[model samples]
Target: MAGFHLPLYRTNLIRSSSSPAPSAYTKPTVVTQNLSYWNSIYSDIESHLKKVIPIRDPVSIFEPMHHLTFAPPRTTAPALCVAACEAVGGNREDAIVAASAIHLMHATIYTHDHLLLTDRVGREPESEIPHRFGTNIELLIADGIMPFGFELLAGSAGDNSEKILKVIVEITGAIGSQEMVAGEDGGVGRPAGLLHGCGAACGAIIGGGNVEEIDRLKRFGLYVGKIQGLLSEKSKNEGCEMELLETWRALALKELEYFDSRKVEQISSIVGV
Candidate 1:
């Protein structure tokens, strides 16, 4: 028998094959090096976005607005981002298109969130969430360089845009309902309950009802809510309310891993893997 090696990545990689007899590997043996691939991918896409959108102003909201559309650079190190890029294994340009769309869509929601917050609490016109969030949006949109996310999906996105648009519409509707709005509304201090509810809905969308995914995202949202609740205590020593936001990156990665694995497993099983 040949000696077996452990799976190098943190998640499990299962393979099933049928050939008169069956073959199974407890883990996969693969290694990768250098973050250059993902960096180039993101950079190339960024370049394209710049060409199309073109930056005009310095104190603009476009730049920060762009950040809202994709996973913040803060979530993953260059290396990890590169690894994810490698795993995607698709047309280089298409990757950028998808990623860019993701960023834009996310930013749109953030813009709305700020608007809601601004309206809820009569903060000085400048002290509103819209003002703060708008600043970032301007910076993102006014970039001299193209955003990478636009390139991720590119021309290949097909009907995905429609689906994404639908999701945004639904989320927006939910926010408009009285149920989703509460508290100061403008500042970071939303009613803890509303935040948690929104977070749970987000988890459902991102987690896709997978048990592990749901568990992780729920915990992520719950912890975030707990932290917010603690901070809002406003009396004694309040603790951190940023836990959910802090863990969101980790949860997102995990959710994607589980979602992909389940998909692969389903495919394998259908083929009698």
Candidate 2:
């Protein structure tokens, strides 16, 4: 749901033959240095996810949660979160907890989206959204993951309580009051845009970004989110115009124009410029 992902895009952060592969937005490249950067973030998030959703007695329910959390295609969201933190001068530690929470939130959203996908074709040989889990089990997985995301946030609350509180509001607001629990919208609309923006904003908040800086990154993320939405539509053969994607990309980069390009060098590279 989050916008043009810096971690995801920047990790392409793997450059491209042209600007970048549209698929770049979906997942990171393996055969690449930033690959290590992204993997480190993934490893940290995975650890937090394990601690928060430890495999318990039934194993049935918990296993799927872990599977979904670590499953591919993986996410660009956590990397973007940490990048936003770094872009604002916060280290990875400052944002790891929130990154983990955001990771789980997206996992639930992804599961919910697959649930809503008709025929559940593509990406799976069996033509099932999730070949392993039943629809009923998926419902459980969808419902289970998001709260644990919040648990990561709430559990990490401390001296940063005020900042964490704002981050809470940002994330929940993006997920939508009902969408978080019901998975109603599937985050295919403006909520998706907000999710991307929320991700950057949360990182900025945790990283101690000033009001102006946070707003700048938030808008940058929103533009990226819009591009992400259109690209998803285009991939499904929905006929999205390429011009719009370029426009959003331009606007996102423009937001960083006045700032020290050095800070956002990786993020700016998202477009492969």
Q: What is candidate 2's TM-score against the reference?
A: 0.76
**Candidate 1 Cα lDDT to native:** 0.35
lDDT of model 2 at residue 167? Answer: 89
Cα lDDT of model 2 by residue, 1-273, tens digit: 113333223341122222344553344322222444445666776776677777786899888887877653555566677778888998888898998888787778767666644554443443444447776887788697888888778888888889999989988887875543333644333255677788788888999999988999888877767766665556556464767767887899898885788898765554434
Best by TM-score: 2
**Which whole-number lDDT from 0 to 100 does residue 64 have in model 1?**
54
After TM-score superposition, the amount by which residue 131's alpha carbon in candidate 2 deviates from its true location, in angstroms, is 2.9
Lowest summed lDDT across 10 adjacent residues in model 1 is found at: 10-19
Q: Write the per-residue lDDT of candidate 1 for residues 1-273, one digit (tens) a residue.
A: 111222222111112111112214222223231223323544664565455444445525444543443323211121121222233332334334333443343344344444433345454353433343544444444332233333433444465564334324333333344434444543343233233323333324322344444344334334334433443342233233344533543444343455466332311111112
Against the hidden reference, what TM-scores do the models get? 0.34, 0.76
Model 2: residues with Cα > 4 Å off, grouped in runs:
1-36, 54-56, 116-126, 177-190, 238-240
